[model samples]
Target: MSDFATNARLATAALRDLFDPTPLQRNDHLSAQYDAEIWLKREDLAPVRSYKIRGAVNAMRKVRATNPAQQVFVCASAGNHAQGVAYACRHFGVQGTIFMPVTTPQQKIEKTRVFGGDSVDIVLTGDYFDQTLAAAQNFCTDQNAHFLSPFDDPDVIEGQASVAVEMLEQLGRAPDLVVLPVGGGGLASGVTAYMRAESPKTQFRFVEPVGGASLTAALAHDGPTTISRVNSFVDGAAVARLGVCTYDFLKWVDPAHVLLAPEDRICVTMLEMLNVEGIVLEPAGALSVDVLPELSDQIRGKAVVCVTSGGNFDFERLPEVKERAQRYSGLKKYFILRMPQRPGALREFLMMLGPDDDIARFEYLKKSARNFGSVLIGIETKSADNFRQLFDNMGKAGFSFRDITADEALAEFLV
Candidate 1:
């Protein structure tokens, strides 16, 4: 075996002291859909509900080994990374202080504390992630703590390689393709390195959230570059910039092999997994599989492995997820209706609805004049065609309306 692959195997074997390997299961549902043998590397089922624990545990192990006097580890993260570090801290009985943005979700904060128990202190600081990270790093320097980076460190990358190690052993051979989700690129770096030396024949497709296409941006520039803004909807995989170390390892990836997933389109995949396969996937976790439809022609009749990176989904987001999915599938729409200022106007509009159509929302904004007014309406139905029929009926009836479901500015202002 190659040296890096050998080292990765050793790292993985040592991890047995922590937890067993996550499952590599053949997903028949996805397989049939794409006409391929689709297997899922279920890192989402790991102890911290993500492969993050692998890197955290391994990084700490290396740190403690080289510096026997090291007792405290520090990190800044809003979700999985914090939990991973916290869990590792408790396991190793070491002191840890984690930093998170003030806007961090309560569930994530609680989960991190729960994993660390009394071994870690959760520090809520700053309103944004960049500011929070700065505070953590400065604090780490002041206290002489080992700052555990979520993805940049070499040891963390090695630890992430453990996933590939387990996959190779489980599969007995390399698959035709490996689909990976990239955020800061720690996991992708490790997996890609191992695959290069060990499973060289296997192809790769890297997925990034469309709004946070750091890796894609980096590859295009031939170096790491910061995006002006990033949408945080795919919180786990949304990064404004690729890590320098990760970019070094991944700089050679072809831009064509990188796929960008739209946030709303990702919601569709999340709903599919939840409803059809009974799998709960966070937006980032669903990224790899979300590309299947786009890559259908290329991946057909091949062996493909998609790594479902995490499942730390907050049930509170379920309603939002459903809404986005419905909208993306064309089954739901929001519109500004030009209603006649008559008492029976709503009744006339209601009569235009088809059998499967239901008015999910209806509110009169204000009366403009004695003869006219405006209403905000939301309609949901069984099929996209229902909206076409409804619109046709409205046009014939002379009731004008504008669909605001896809109007980003208007959706934010009103919806």
Candidate 2:
């Protein structure tokens, strides 16, 4: 075996003492849909519901073996990584201090505390992840505690490679193609490295949220590059910049092989997996599967593996997810209408709707002059094409309206 494969095997063996290898199940639903042999590496089933625990456990193991005197571990995370580090700290019986952004959801904060138990101290600092990360690093230096990175560390990357080891063993063969989600690139880098060494025939496709395409940005620049802004909709994978160490291993990846899944489109995938397959995936967790449709032709009749990286979803976000899905599917739209003040004008406008069209929302803004009044209207239809017909009818009927469904600024204020 190659050196990387050997190391990954060792890491996989060590992890068995902590948790069993997560399932590598053939998903009949997705397979039939895509006409491919779709297997899912259920990293969501890991102890901390993410592949992150693998890295955290391995990093901790290596650290304590060399220095038994190391009693403290520290990290900064807004979600899964913090929980993974906390769980590892408790398992190792080491004291841990986790720094999280003040804007972090209470559900995540509570879960981190639960995993770490009395072994951890939760510190809510900074409004954003960068600030919290800086605080964690400075505090670790001041306290002489070992700071565990979410990604970017060599030991952490080695730990992540264990996923590939497990996948090969569970599947009894290397998959023809492996799809991975990209965030800080720890999991993707490790899996790619291990597979390159152990199963050179396997091809890889990387997925990232469109609003946070850090890996694509890195590939475009020939190195790691920071984005000016990132949409946090896919919180698990919305990394502003790819990690340096991760990019080192992934720098040669072809930019074309990296697919960008839109955040809104990802929400539709999340809801579909939940409703159709009864599989609940967080936005990042759904990344690999979200891109499956794009690869349908290429992967037809081939054995494919999709790593469902995490399942740390909060049920409270379901409404938001559904809303995004509706918007993306074009089944829902918002519009501002200029209604004539004539007594029968409202009735005339209502007559333009198709039988399948339903008014989801309607409100009238009064006008002092009485010639016309502003109306905020929302409509849901059975078919997306119905909107074109509805707009056409409205135009011929002399009703003036402005479609605000795609207007980000207007939607934020009114919708």
Candidate 3:
């Protein structure tokens, strides 16, 4: 076995001291829908509810073994990584200091604290992750504490390879295709490296949130590249820049093999997995499964494994998820309509609605004229084509309207 594979095996054995292997169960629902054998590497069932614990435990174990006196570890994370570090600290009886953004959800903060218990200290600083990371690094230097990176270290990558090791053992053979979600590229890089060494015939595909295509941008430029703007909707995988160490391993990936799943479209996938399959997935966790439809023709009748990276979704975000799914599915729309001020004008407009159309919102924007007023209206329909028919009927009736649902700038403020 290669040195990396040997180390990964050792790490997998070491992980048994914490939690057993996560399940590699075939998902019948996804398999039937996609017309292929679908298996989910359920990292969501890990001790920290994510595969991040593998990296944290592996890195910390190596550091402590080398320097037995090194009892302090530090890291910066807003979600999974923090909990992973906390859990590892408690397991190894090491002191940990975790820095997180002030805006991080209370559920994650509480979970991290619960995992670490008295072994870790939680510090809330900065509004963005970069600021928090900088603070943690500087503090580590000043205090002489070992800093644990989320995905940028070799030890961490080796630890992450344990996931693939477990997959191969559980499946008893290499899958035809392995689909993984990419953020800083730790999991994808590590898993790909392990698979390439052990099962060279396996094909790999990487998925990332479209709004935060750090891996795609890095591959396109042949190196790590930073995006000026990133949507944090997929907070777990919304990295501004790909990690340098992780990129080194993933640099050989074909750009075409990287799939960018849209943030709103991911919401639809999350909802589908939850409602239809009874699986709750965070936006990042659903990345691999979300892109399966795009790969339908290529993967038909093939054995495919999708890494469900994490399930740390907050129930509070359900409403937003539903809104984004509705918008993406064309079940919801926002428009500004010029309303007639005369009597029975409202009744006349209401009569134009199709049987499945329902008005969700109506608000007066401004007075357009002495006999007319501008109104903002939100509508939900059973089908996307319903909007076209409604617009046509409105046009024939001389009702002027502007669809604002697709207007990003205006929608941000109004919708």
Q: What TM-score goes with each of the models? A: 0.99, 0.98, 0.98
Give the alpha carbon lDDT tens digit for every residue of 359-380 in model 3: 9989998866787898899999
Clashing residue pairs found in predicted model 1: none
Better of 2 and 3 by TM-score: 3
Question: Which candidate number would show the highest lDDT if scored against the true structure?
Answer: 3
Quote the positional error of residue 161 for candidate 2 in Å. Answer: 0.9
lDDT of 1 by residue, 58-120 (tens): 999989999989998999999999999999999999999999999998999999999999999
Cα distance off (Å), candidate 1, residue 181: 0.3
Candidate 2: segments with Cα more than 4 A from true spot: none
